[model samples]
Target: MEPKTISTARTARYISLGEPGADIQHVFFCLHGESQALADFAAQLVNFDTPERLLVLPEALSRYTMPAGPAGAPLTVASWFAADSLLPDLADLTAYLDELAAEVLAHCPAGVPVTVLGYGSGAAAACRWLAGGRTHYDRLLLYAPVFPPSIDRRATLVGLPDRPITLISTTTEAFTTEAVGAGLLQDLQDVGLSAQHRYVSEGPLTLAALGTVGK
Candidate 1:
């Protein structure tokens, strides 16, 4: 199958991975962190080893550069939602996700298990996607996510009933010292979501652990 492309004037990009004709029983859609591109975690799929059978989709957003970076340095970055600067809104992201879901459905057969994985701000985007009701996924993996102040955790919890979610954080001393991370874990659990929090010594999200959950 030929590779398909999606582009916008804002500079967002999405790419599909794995064998085209293989039996695709699982699908993984990853949302990248702040100031980071999809390329950062694209290679990490090898650690999962399930990419060959799972259709992986990575999406990039359009963002502006910060003048504070350096003297007159123009930086271009991707973001799912606006942070400090005025960029894309949640509606833009929701539309993109709708298109993405349609594309994934068109590429694969029915009854395929789908997983949505988000890191940092991507986590926020994933949560918003789940709240929007555009698509239904089997699992949601969050890696050191930073929640936005505007999001109402209670309101977002309405339609998501007992969805399986995994929260993976760094085990480094620095992260442990910050109680905020632990607080987020508690908050997620308090909302009646089937959530798991794991401290990773050092490694990206892997499929080995996720596969066990799927089974």
Candidate 2:
């Protein structure tokens, strides 16, 4: 049988860390990795919370229950996209994120700096959204980023050259290594894109550690 595709809608949730109003000075769009809940990811970034900056955490649409511990409750988490549903999920995510960002930006004043941060598997999602979505960010920060093969490098070259892209690594990165980080930076630099690699200690990746990027 031939495959068929259809579109549908469902209610999704995202976490906003700070108020969205005239007092807001910066906006941070953070994407979480696979098997991670939005609330859990928000906690990792709670230290970055400030009165002037807004942190928007968009939860992935695809969710599943994880194997619970013998005495623990059932755990649920989300992934931005699965390998089998890559294309369709990408389309849905792009639309969802675009709408969410637009709504947040609408509440803020003009010319507020927008920063996009992606952690682990979320790095590619941030790249995909920025490549195709309508929301424009001033800088990009990837923490132990895992860039998928499906990412559009050409689009990255075109869209990201003028903007800064920082590939953040640590002494104990679980997925990405120092060599991998260096190579990714080299590739971006080869294409004349302003990319850099930075190293941090083994700890929670925070905005304070990544001082003055794209400033």
Candidate 3:
């Protein structure tokens, strides 16, 4: 199916692969990291052959050109929420996700299993999205996510049930260090989110790895 695009209030864009009506049983929301576009993750999902899987990539609202400081050296852009700014306000993010989710649901069917995957700050956005109860996603996949310092780990745990989420981290990546990753795992568990943390070797993220966790 031809891919469709949507414009968000943050002035960002989102891309989708597979027909909106292709019997979508599962939806994958891939939130890109800093300085990355939705297409960055879309390329990986294109490698998969699963007809039932639909991938949606939403670009961050904020745009930051590549810092190489050369004319058109290589433009790098990211979503507004991908930056390492101070602690994020959950309410603001929820509003953004609410708008984006509405656009997504407009083109897709209802009751499809939703999976949210966030890399870096995008992970934190995903967490906030889940916590806000704006969308009914079945699974949340966090890849090297950074949690907000202001986030009350205990408070966030109130509504999350056990075994509905999975956290994926890398051992070699500086962002997902063993200590930090372990802390996140413990926090999720304490909140009764039913999370499983995995330690992968340093390497590129792939659909195969994501599919493993989705299973």
Best by TM-score: 2
How high a TM-score does candidate 3 get?
0.76
TM-score of each: 0.76, 0.89, 0.76
Candidate 3 residue lDDT tens string, 187-210:
776765667666565555555566
Which has the higher lDDT value, candidate number 2 or candidate number 3?
A: 2
Query: Who is ahead in lDDT, 1 or 2?
Result: 2
Per-candidate count of clashing residue pairs (backbone under 3 Å): 0, 0, 6
Residue 141 shift from truth in candidate 1, angstroms? 0.9
Write the residue-wise lDDT of candidate 1 on 129-172 in tens digits: 77775787888887777766666645565546467888877766
Prediction 2 global C-alpha lDDT: 0.80
Error of 1 at 164 (Å): 1.0
Model 2, 83-104: lDDT tens digits are: 7678898889889999999999
- Candidate 1 clashes between residue pairs 3 or more apart in a chain or in different chains: none
- Ten-residue stretch with the least lDDT total in model 3: 80-89
lDDT of each: 0.65, 0.80, 0.65
The global Cα lDDT (0 to 1) of model 3 is: 0.65
- Runs off by more than 4 Å, candidate 2: 150-161, 178-180, 213-215
